[model samples]
Target: MSTCRTGTGPLTAAELEDWYAVPLGRADGTWVRAGLVTSLDGRAAGPDGLSGSLNRGSAGDHAVFDHLRRWADVVVVGAGTVRDEGYGPLPAVPLVVVSRSGDVPARLRRAAESGTRDGPAVVVLDGHGEDVDPGRVLTEVASRGWRRVLLEGGPQLLGTWLEADAVDELCATVRPVLVGGDGPLLVPRSTSLRAPVGSTTHLLAWEGDVLVRTRLR
Candidate 1:
């Protein structure tokens, strides 16, 4: 990824990977990191109401998205986002779909049922009639030894995690565009956490996309 930070040249691929890696000594608890793409006006989706649309032509954002996925030991996403984004199975990386109804995307359902080895096992984590608890999800993730967690979200899912204080880091890519109509924000308006949650750790730019890393604790 190219960095536009002053006094620095483009970052090498290894350097970029290091920037996204889990801290060296973080073995005690799960490190939950969220990845989201937003527009210049703070809208999480484009006019199309899908996050992928926000990064439509931005290679940098796409690169960072892939990097985050590769860095994750397990990927957690809400069922709605998975459906809205037309998500498929990832090769060798477990995908945990959190759903209130215990429903998952069709492709994942097929993959899970077929006992397919071509992709990572698709797991449906039901909330058992309650709001899917972020803590519960993380506990299960830790149980599986997948501590380097990545949360790809729909806004409601992200807001819930933020309210529960289950998120450790947030990796946001701000595209240089605007979608002025009503669109989702980074978090839900009803989220109880009134204050901003984290400290800015890194601000790097690549191909007009600004990547921000915020440490939540």
Candidate 2:
């Protein structure tokens, strides 16, 4: 296991590659693991919606994010995150919104539309069977030819996937900052993998942050 610890301000490209490259292999054709950066105190969010505090990575992290987006046919995010972060669609990848309810904020719709030409296609995951249709949502997303999907999430979404055993890998970038707040942890609760679980650590050269990559064994 390779581990890097950073006491400096943020992360660099080398650090990002060291963190993200191996987890990229964990995702088979069907699923990809969710990746996130969290404070040592286990806060995924700051007071505000922006993760800028956690975004202190070198150019490499940005490049890694871009690569992940490119490799993923569909990028999945919870609706709340889309509203809070004001997320937009990637150039070529399709954006899949997992909303139990059909209430999608107009800004996301507009952003997805303007960014992706035909607007973003919304997929509401009706786990509750409320007013939405899960069948139609799955069908529409499948129609776009997105076989492999990546879920970039807030805690709740991550928890849901973990409970369902739908996650294939989990890549986490643990920064050295200790922002002790009752914010949120990377994983909501304890989860057991289906069978084998393997992990590797990469020590970043510049930043002392460690990237831990875990896959289903």
Cα-based TM-score, every candidate: 0.89, 0.70
Candidate 1: residue 123 lDDT (0-100): 73
The TM-score of candidate 1 is 0.89
Model 2 is weakest, by summed lDDT over 10 consecutive residues, at 129-138
Clashes of 2: 14
Which residue runs of candidate 2 sit more than 4 Å off their true CA positions?
A: 1-28, 110-143, 189-198, 201-206
Compose the digit string of candidate 1's lDDT tens values, residues 1-217: 2222221214566877877766643557567889999988989999989987788887767777788878888999998898889888878689988888867876787776777745667777777666799888878887878888889998889989998988888899888898988889988788898676677767877777788888875
lDDT tens digits, residues 1-217, model 2? 5344433324454644444554333233355557676667776765454555575653434444565676676777877677777775555767777676645676555555455344335443534534223234435656776656677777767766665566667756566677665666666655444554444433333355655556633
Candidate 2, residue 100: how far the Cα is off, in Å: 2.6
Off by over 4 Å in 1: 1-10, 24-29
What's the count of clashing pairs in each model shown? 0, 14
